[model samples]
Each structure stands twice: as structure tokens, then as C-alpha cells.
Target chain A: MSVEVEVNENDLAEMVEQVWESYLDPEGINPLIPTYDENQPSEVHSSVSISGSWTGHIVYACSIEAARRAAAAFLAMEPDEVSQEDLSDVLGELANIVGGNVKAMLPPGAFLSLPQVVLAPESTARFPNTERISGVYGIWDGEPVSISMWHSRADNNQEDGA
Target chain B: MTLSQPEFAFVSTLVRKEASIVLAPGKEYLVEARLIPVARAVGAANVNEFLAELQRRPNPAHQRKIIDALTTNETSWFRDREPFAALTDVILPELIKSRATTRKVRFWSGASSSGQEAYSLAITLQEALPSGWNYEIVGTDISTEMVKRAETAEYSQVEVNRGLPASQLVQYFERAGAHWRVTSQLRKNVSFKLMNLTAPLPAMQPFDVIFMRNVLIYFDVATKRTVLQNVAKLLRPDGWLFLGAAETTIGIDDNYERVAAGRTSAYRVRTGVPAGASRRG
Candidate 1:
């Protein structure tokens, strides 16, 4: 099965919108143009992997300023009081929620892995032999947040795409 | 715009009387968070005004809405994976054998919010049970809105995401516009009812498995004990009971003896003793 055809950017956008509306702020997220601005790499990046019917990763990234405000809103705290660990957790949960919805669109039996968070000044997290198949770029509470789906090329070669 | 102490107290008392859910002092944020939308929906100026209006008029339907608002339906499919894993790995095998003569098993999703837990049980049994075997699931919630939502079996994208495995989503649910609707196969044997656990339970058949997960935290010790006792009345002698991870019958009820079921714990009615016989003495 072509992973790109099965799950695409529009599916990712809807999942992101749902997570934002349910947890963070209702109707606060709006889809951005489907283009990446590599000059402003997100300070924090979080991702969760899917294994089984499809193998890949869903990554969420956002600026540090945005992360603090989002974390505060999620934890019901003031933005200044949000900690580094809180930012990591909130981003990880966002990735997990988006990942889970995306996983549902895939073939049956896809297992979602625990969320992994990266706190860095740049987009440093990498997945070897994986290609980005689909992505959704959106703005939430004025912060640029994006979710991307990566399909593992190694898994593609190794397993029969049953 | 903020929920004041009196408004909070009023809501807490109303909810306690209506649904037996205790809204403690610090949960002002919870009340505010859950009720702001309710306030907006009803065209109240704010949560404070909503409470004022509720007290002034004393409308049963509006009071029911307040109770429903306070009682959070925070549930997901196969929430807390170990319990479901245990059902497949340990409990079902035993129940299948014990009920071999009848070839039927019944389940109760006690405190089933929006029917995820109940549907989860249906999916579990559908996959695990042998051919020619039959099953039934009855889900109950105090909130009329939730019961209706559960009966509909239509869930939003976010609702379906939580704790639901992808394979089951593909197998059991079909897309209805933007939302996902649980397929007829999963809904056929399952039904939801508007019943309060703290109140006298409606007449129902004894169930082989009863899941009262993640709901006891909202009650005080006495209410918990009473609810557990009431639940015990409907559970078969050899049936299984799954409470939330943090909840237990150890101090509250003596009739239940805990049994380790796979990675989680399940309670069984102690053999060699009459049902509801307290072992505390």
C-alpha cells in the first residue's frame, strides 16, 4: 500500500485541528500554506512512531515561545510558570494525539509508540532511512505548529506491504 | 466571569444531589473549564450567571445539564491497555470455559462514558470468542446526554484517537461525514441506558463481566461502598469485576476478593460465602 495515498496532508490537518480543539483551544488552530520555513527551526520537536500495518513517525514542532504558552494553556498555568519539562510533555502529548488519529487512517493493526520529545535550538531530530510522505502546517494561538508523517524506507524494503 | 465560592458550592451541591459526584473546593478550575461552554450554550452571561439561573428556576432538564457538565466523560477506547490485554489473555479464556454449556456471556460497562468502554468490550469479545458463541453488553451512565451520545456510537476524530488501536478502528468503525461511527456489528449486541449507580439500579440481567473503571474517584467513601454493593447485586456469582487502577474493594466492600488477572487485577465474589457477606468482621 502506498503510504502517501493512504494518509495525506489533509488528513494530518484534520487530526491536528481535532487535537487542538479538544485539548488546547477550540477553533484556535488554522491551516497554513503547505510550505516549510527552514530558516526558523522549531526549538522543541516531539514525535511518535507507528509500527505494524504501517511503519513511520509523526513529528510535531514549534517555537520555544509558543511551546511555553501552549504548555501553560494545557496545564492550566501561567505562561511564565511553565517549565522546560512541561514544554516537553505538552509537545509530546500533542504529537501522540496527532499520531494516534493518523494511525487510525492507516491499515489495521498499526501500533503507536510512546512519544519522544527533543528540546533543541534547531530541528535536530532525525529518522534514518525514512522519507516524509505527508505534512500539515498550522498556526495555533499565533504559534506555528506543524505535523509531518514519515515512512521508513528500510521497512518498505524489508516487509511485504500487506 | 470567574466561578465564585457560592456558585461553586451551589454547583457542587446540585451535582452531588443529582449524580453523586463531589466537586471539591480546588476543582473550581474543573467546573469552570467544563461549564464555560454550557454557559455559552444556554446564553448565560457566564458560569456564575448560569449557576444563578439554575438556582432561580430549578428546571429539571437544565439541572440535568449542569450535572452532565460536571461529570466529565473523559474516556477512550480500551483505556488503560492492561485491563483489555488481561481480558484477552486471561479472563475471556476462563469465562468461555465456565459458560461453555450456555455459549453466551454478558458484560456491563458500568460508568460507561459515551460508550467507548462498552464498545471496547464488544470489540474484544467479537475478536476473542469462538464461532457460535454470543455476547451482550449493557452500558449505563447517569448523564442523559452521555447515554444518548453513547447510543449514537458516533465519535469525533479526537474521541476515536484516545486508547483505540488502529486495527480495531478500521475493523469496527465507519466514517459518517467527518466523525467516525461504530459499525452495526459492534453496536448490535451493545445498548446504553440512563441509570445512576448511586440510585437504585434498574432491573437487569446478571452480567459475567462488569467494568466500573475510572469512575469511583468522583465519589466519597460511603458512596463508593454503596455503589460497589449495588454493583455486586447484579454481578453473577462467578463473574469478574474490573475497577479503575486506583480503585479497590479492600476497605470499601468485604465480599470481593481480589484476583490477579494477567498484568492487571480483577475482583471475584469470594466463594464459600453468601453474596454481600462482609468479611470485615
Candidate 2:
């Protein structure tokens, strides 16, 4: 008895804003403006999977400079003091948070998987058997950060009912 | 630009007068990091402009925001894994044995920020304690904003993602629109209030366990001693006290002695103190 969950571009925008305000910045002033740049290269990438009611993947990719600055703010340290491990952890956590929220919108029984991180320079993640459904791209602290949702197409006959 | 000496001093002084939290010189970066966004929110270009405006004319609402911003520490479910382990493995087993006659237990979360710690305790009791056993948890914080948020008992996904395992979440919480709310089964056993540790405390029932962790770092030496003294008054003579890994009662208070509890250490009133010595009803 699983129903469709509608997640539009606006939904993605709002989810990113909520995550940033709650964790990365308390004051909620550092807003992320929506942008469009698919080919933008990122130094760090992370993702999480959703299963059960609806199946999909939520991907979070950001430039190294952006990752470092975010880690610094999160730990309340200087940007230069941020280590590569810290950057990876922060990015992975962000993806988990965003993915967890998106999972909540779907029907009951949806479960979010553990977050995974890829640390190669100028790297991007690709999820097999899934197509990019919707995404939000934005500039945070003058660096690129993107959150995109992909739907699994394992069963072509199933309607993308949302 | 960074926060100037005058700006930092202004914020530090205000925070001290209001909340009694000392912001030392090295904390300039912290002030800037926290207050810069606040400044922008109030229409100021930067921290400097925000302080200048506040100095020219004080606004209680604006100042309250500053205090909340600085005092709002990051919190997560079962934050710092070892402490919760201590609760589950060491502290509760001992307490359950001692309270066999009463079949009840009480806990106090002295610095519960947004109610995670208190709820976590409730969930633990639900899963660990035997049937027919009853428990209660009281959460107190100095910030009014935090107290209100705690009372709501709702948390965003980002808030819950921090250190909360998915299994515990699905079992203890139910979805509320876009957020999650604590199940009434757990919520009924927990309550939250606004109280300042640096100030005189109100009458309260003695607790079997007191979690006053990670908050002593904000207070000066004298204030820390006083807070511990206040807590000791409300704790049963043999009750357990858990402080942050970095905090201790060895040098601050002599009434308590530290003992090992699995991966962490807990404090209990020193020997020679009569049983129920400080227990108030």
C-alpha cells in the first residue's frame, strides 16, 4: 500500500534551507540561493538510499572550499584548521540529514540507508538503475553545493506516480 | 572583517550580565561566527554594525536573541556514545537493584538543550526496565527559547540525524507531517522547564540520577562550585552524577567521589555522608 511522494524543485530548496539553518548555521542568515549549473565540478560527494514505499537516492556534492568552510562553521573552528576527514564527515552527515528528510515525505515503511562519501577531487556520484528526478543547486558561502534526488527505475512498468 | 575588541567586549559583557557565561579573549572567533548571522538577520551589514546599533540603543528582544544564539550548544541523541552506555550498562542496573522496593526511578537533565537528552533517557528506560516499573525525567535549561522548543517535542530530520540510529528512531518516534514527534508513551514520562543553574533553584523531588554534563564549561570556577552544590542538594546521597568527559568534581566539590562505570566515570556522594543525606522528600 505505498503511495507516490511528490518532491518538486521548491521542496528541494526548502529542505536544503531547513538543514542549513538547523545544523550548519544557527542564525539562519547564510541563505543558499538557487542556481543552475549541472556540469559544476565538486571535490567531495556523498549520498544515501531510500527503499520500501519508494526507492531513490539523495546526492550531496560540494566544492572543497565550500566543504572546508562548512566544516569550520560546524565545529566552530578556523577554515584552514579543517582536516580532509572532517570535510568528508560533514558532507556525509549533510547527505544523511537531507536524505532522511526526503524519506519522511514518502509513504510509511520507507527506510534511509547509511550515508556514503567519495573524496576524490572533482568527482561526482552515479547511481545505477536510477534517473535524476529533481534537484536544487545553490551557492553557499560563495561556493557550489547541490542536493539532488534520483528515483530507481528497476521496474519500468511501474508508474513514477507522484 | 573580524570582531573588534570593543564589539567582542560588548557581547561578552552582555552575555555575562545576563547568563553569567564568561567569553574570554580567545573566543573572538566564536563570537564572530555566531553573531555575524544574527547581525545580518537584524538588517546590520556585519557584527560591527549590529553592536554599534545595540550600544546606541539597547533592545531587550535583540539582546535575548544574542544570548540564545551563544548559549544554544549543539546537541544530539545519545550524544557522546559512552555516557549513554554507562547509563544502560552500569548506572541503571545498580539503581534498579537499589530501588526494588519502590519500583520507580527519577532523572534530571540539568542542561537539556531542545530535550534530546531527556527523551533519550526515557527511551532507554522503556526498553531496559521491567514491566510495571515507572520512571520520570525532568529537563531544565536557562534559555527560554530552548525550553519552548523542548516542550514542543518535535524535531527536524537534521536534528535527529545527529548520532540517532535509524532503528531507535522508528521505534520511539512517529512522523508529524515533515518532522518527527516523540511517542506519547515516552513523552508522558518526560517534562521540560526553564531554570538557570547559576541562580537559586526551586523545590524539587530528589532524583536517582542527575545528568549535568557539558554545561560547567560555561561557568566560572565559583559558579561551577555553586551549581554543583545546588545539584547535590537535590540528588539522593547514593545517586549517580554524570558530567561531561572534560568536567569533574575532584577539584570543584569534595562532597562527591568519582567511580568507574564501564567506559565512563560517574560521581556519587563521598562516604561518611549519611544515607539520604541531601534527599529532600
Candidate 3:
């Protein structure tokens, strides 16, 4: 029997919150909210694929507004002054850092793919055998935002034998 | 004048043709970020105005800054970990054994940025190798400003935080007010030089190992092939080449074959030929 310990929705939410608080900004200006729907949510997202002893993908997805606000807050710029590419880079770096930390929590020897940003949630669908873990929270501006994590069990099973 | 897609495209194409550096499609922001500040400093109103002025009268100083900014300096001591561990455990031991007969070992870092990678290697050698072993470390980069910084060996907090562990930092660096300077002993083993990889390498002794990581990604396939061939010429037949984790020589060049030591992938020049023949081969 293979034991796969997956991060829970709440734990994933806390991880995202902690990452944003520590790495991005301390003012807690752009708090991430975690939300889920019976149907998959449609939103802007960034993700990094983790491989090695245990293999999977970690994704950070949220609304466009939340992403823009987060980018502005992270860069310490007015929202209007933030460009789309800058927002994408900020979000991508966020996903990379959070994914890197999460990779540390997994069994040692996980390889991380370069981080990527996408326009919508469908982007995360490219990776196979994904399970979504998600949560919701309120920003300092009282905007509702969501954070989600996804893992692929297939990749984990392959690494177990190697 | 205002910045436009065509202008960005022109600059990207020129860089690719002249230097063989690849500027991926979405990286226009990087170009704009580097050029805008230089433009303002040169009294241009905007990026377009700067480009127009640059076209009308190309100032070497402004051009140098643009190139410096465009070059990515993402490096850290003992970056990616496994390679350095392998260097310490396997490569260095073999090199030491071989060099014992000759009494000297030489190493080069082809794209050393701000001296972190080169100094890291030096520290590793000092810690791992036997006392009184003779070794030389030479570092070179295209940016004059970066080479100057490397020569000074001082680093900011943000620069030091990347991959440097606190213990290593304490052992290797002398703290000044808010910055840290690499000790003279470590600095003594290595020398920094300004070199554009697109140009021919300087007259230097053959090297047992060359750490040319990460920089290859910037170059085009032809440039990669040319650079690897040039590197192979400079490398002793048994010497090793270390590339970034994401980089590989498989498709780009065949002059050097990949060799594995533990988890790290390194390259060695194909054997059974004289150094001159290998360069021609």
C-alpha cells in the first residue's frame, strides 16, 4: 500500500496566506481568499510543477482583481500603474516561492518546474491526474479572494518505485 | 517619440543577430525597464525618444549600461547544491589525483557574475582539497560594471541571502557596516576579467574544469554550439564542464559528452585526440 499525504484545503489556504505575508508584503494589504465551487472556478492562476521522490503540481489561482491588487501591493505601486506583465511576474514569483516551500514539506528530492502564469483556471488542466485543495479569505480592502493547490497522484506513484 | 512593438522587435532582433542572446517574446518588459532609466539619464523624454536618440548617435557608455542591465545576474554560491557536492566528492578528488603528478590544477568560470559562483568554488576547494595543493580560479563576464563589483567582492544583504548559508557566510565574509566583503585569501585565489563570450576567449592556460552554467540559455543554438566548441578548445581532454541544471549540451553540441557523478551531470571533452585535434574534431 502506498501512503500519499495530501495537503488539506484549509492547510493549503494557510500556506498561501503565510507565503504572501512573509515573502510579498507585511502590511497584509492583499490577503488571499480561498474558495471552491462544485464546478471548477474560472480565474487567473500561476503554478509550478514539483517532481522527484514525490511528484505533483502546486497551483495558486485567484480572481483577476485580486491578482492585480496583489501585484500592486507587492510592488508597492498604485494598481493603475501596475502593468499586466508585471502582475503576471509577481504572481508567478509568488507561486514559485510558495511551491518551493511546499516542495520542502514533501519527501526530499522533489524537482520544481519553472513557474508559469495563465489567464484562467483552465491552464492548470494541462497537467494530468490533479486533485484540487482550496480555501477562501478576505483582503485588507475587504475583497474576497481564493487560493487553491493541486497535486497529481500519478506522478507520485511513478517515483515510489524509482 | 514613444515606444512601440516594432521598436522592441528591432532591438530584440539586433541583440539576437549581434550577440545571439535570445529575448523571449514576453520579456519586452525587461528591455523597457533597462532602457527607460538609461534614456532618462541621457536626457531622453521616453523610451521611444531614447531609441531615436540612440539610433541618431549611439553612445558607448549608454549602450554598455543597456547591455549590463539586460544581462541576467541570477547566481548564488553553491547554487543547486548537488553539483558542488559532486565537485567536492568526485571531480575534485580525481583532479587532485591527476594533478599530483603535475603539481597544479586550473579552473575557469566562463560567465561568473559578481564572483559568487567563483568564490563558492574556491571555498569548496579550500575546504575539500589537501593543504598545499596548487589551484587557480579565473572568472570572466561581459559586463565591466559586474566585473568591477566582482573584483571588489562586496555584496549587499539581498545579494547574500540567495543561497549562502549563515555558517558559510560567517566563515567566508568580513562584515562591514551593512555589507560583507569576501576575505582577501578567498579573493586571492580568483581573478575577475571582463569578457564577452561572443568574442574569442583571452589567452589563458588550459583548465581542468569550467563552470559555465546558466549563461548558455541566453544564447541561440548557433551561439551555444560555437561557445561549447570554444569551451572544448580551452578544456583539457579530461577536464569537466558544468552547465545549469536546466541546460544540456545534447542537441546543441556533440564535442563534449555528458558524464554523471552521483546526481550531477557534467561534461568531458571526447578523449583519444590531441588538444589541437579535438578542437578541429
Number of the predicted model whose TM-score against the real structure is largest: 2
Tens-place lDDT digits, model 3, residues B1-281: 33478878877765665345788887666678667767787688888887777678754445545555565446567877888899888998888888887767788988887888888988888788788776789999877867998899987555677789899888999754335789987888899899877667677788988999876766667767777877877898889999987788887775678999768889887676544343322
lDDT of 2 by residue, B1-281 (tens): 88888888899998887666898898887788788768887799888888899899976557866886787545688877787888889888988899999999999999887899999888888988889899999999877878899989988766778788899999988887567899999999999998988778998999999998877755666777888888888888889899987788878777788999889898988878753243322
Each candidate's fnat: 0.11, 0.16, 0.00
Q: Which run of 10 residues does model 3 chain A get worst, by summed lDDT?
A: A27-36
Candidate 1 runs further than 4 Å off: A1-162, B4-33, B38-46, B49-73, B277-281
- Which segments of model 2 are wrong by more than 4 Å? A1-14, A18-30, A33-103, A108-162, B5-33, B37-46, B49-73, B274-281
Models 1 onward score TM values of 0.59, 0.63, 0.55
For model 1, the TM-score of its B chain against the native B chain is: 0.80
- Candidate 2 lDDT (Cα, 0 to 1): 0.82
Model 2, C-alpha of B26: deviation from truth (Å)? 13
Q: Mind giving the per-residue lDDT tens digits that candidate 1 earns over B50-127?
A: 888878876554675676666544566788888899999998999889999999999999888788889999999999
Q: Give the range of the ten consecutive residues with the poorest summed lDDT in model 1 chain A.
A: A26-35
Question: In order, what lDDT does every prediction score?
Answer: 0.80, 0.82, 0.72
* Candidate 1 TM-score versus the reference: 0.59
Q: For model 3, which pairs clash?
A: A33-A137, A33-A145, A33-A146, A34-A135, A34-A136, A34-A137, A34-A146, A35-A135, A51-A111
